[model samples]
Target: MRAIATPGGLPISDPAALVDVEVEAPQALPHDLVVRVEAVSVNPVDSKVRLSANPSDTPRILGYDAAGTVTAVGQEVSGFAVGDEVYYAGAIDRPGSNADYQAVDHRIAAHKPTTLSFADAAALPLTALTAMEALEDLFHVGANSEGTLLVLGGAGGVGSIMIQLAKRLTSLRVIATASRPETAAWAREMGADEVANHHDLGAEVLRIVPEGVDYVLSTHSEGQIGAFAEIVKPLGHIAAIDDGNLNLSPLKPKRISWHWEFMFSRSLFQTPDIAVQGRMLADLATMVDAGEIRTTATQYIEDFTAAGIREAHRRIESHGTQGKIVVTR
Candidate 1:
């Protein structure tokens, strides 16, 4: 099987950082699906792993988001079959989706949306799963929930889906943060009720919701923990995906509840309820088919070459892309 991998951790700017290689095809485990990968999407996790995690003697594959057709299934796999088309963000502990074939746990894989192409479907899994878990699991948001929610990094891949899910699935008044006009417009296009500049987030949000937002989901909450504390309402829920040293001192008075949403958590740990991710993807597919949600694939890499993968990583690391980037074979 043809694949892309990194032999050692190196900066993205290194000309030889990512390379093409030929590797053995993966076989299905007892509960796995061996997928013939057609398309893969790049995310921030790819770059982070590439830069930080040391690769084994066999080069390490770095993609997590993929849409493909199941070529074979393990004995215990029940929800999917050999001919099924599926999309999933593979477990971080396993070899990734950047290859011609990958073995994914069927519990976290769902049938691809019929309305979308392989590339478009590939773009949704990782980001959509993260967004869904953040809102529905960590924040406990429901269709009847009523509150003002602020989303940081509103136009990025996860935030793009977050905006849509909040609008379509819940009654939360959505406010998103984007620094540029184009990104702000994109957030609004994704169904955000309002968009504010992240650079002046406190003021921008305060101007619109004077009492402060009831919930804050900071997708890239690295240095703005204090800023979030200042803008969130008392007893509100604050969730984030980024890992950093956070000081909860300021939020004590407000009684804020902090949560972290790592989409890979269930699969990474082989949790008993890992199948929930597959079920959520199925739900997302229904919403997409019903026209309540849209694909976030704004950037497309025409070919699945090594150079193309490098370019996709560059765009994701730049942190300026408005939506997801997909590379197709």
Candidate 2:
């Protein structure tokens, strides 16, 4: 198997930051499926792990979003079989999808949408899981739910799906924050009812909904906690998926609730409902086939080379790319 890995967790700018090498294929565990990866997408987590994670004796493979075909299945795997086309966000604790072959827990993997290409399908898993969990599991929004949702960072990878899901699955009046004109347009394309500048978040939101928003999904969670606290309605829910110091004192007065959404939690902890990730991805696949949810892969790397992967990491670290960046064979 061919793989791209970081030996010492070096910076992306380093020439040897990611290297291509030949390695033995992973064996399937009791609940695992060995997948032959066709396409993979870059996420912020990849860059974070590459730069700051503890170095490993062996090179560490760093990728989460992947679309591939199952070449072998574990003894306990039930829903998938050999030659099944599947997609998943690989578990954080395991060797990831940045290789020709990867062993993924079948509980978190689902059949890919028949309507999309491998690159497009690869872009949806991590972001779709995160957005679905943030909106439904954390915020308790559903089909009948009617309220306003302010999606922070509404033009990025997760935000792209968040905006679409909110509109298609729920009755929430969607408001999204995007600073750039192009991003704002993209957010609207994704089904946001209104788009506001993140620079003046409070004012921009207030202008759309006279009262505060009922829910806030902070995808880009840096320095926006205070603004979220100030702009949310009393007893509203706030969910975020970023790493940084946060102050919750501001939320106390309004009796607001805050949740941390890490899409990898279920698979990482081997939770009882770990299969929910697979279920959700399957449902999302249905939606995609029905033309309800669209892929967020705005940029594509034509070849799966070390240089291409490095450039993808560089763009993700720069924090300016819209939607998702996928690399395919």
Tens digits of per-residue lDDT for model 2 on 1-329? 88988876688889788988788999999999999999999999998888886777688888999999999999999978899999999999999898999999998999999999999999999999999998779888799999999998889998999999999889999999999999999999999999999898878888888789999888766777788778999999988888788887888989989899999999889889999999999999999999999999999997787888898999998988999999999
Write one digit per residue (lDDT tens) for candidate 1, span 137-213. 88888999999999999999989999999998889999999988999999999999998888878888999998899
In model 2, pairs of residues that clash are: none
Give candidate 1's whole-model lDDT: 0.90
**Each model's RMSD to truth, in Å?**
1.0, 1.0
Per-candidate TM-score against the hidden true structure = 0.98, 0.98
For candidate 1, the 10 contiguous residues with the lowest summed lDDT are 219-228
Assess candidate 1 and give its TM-score to the true structure.
Answer: 0.98
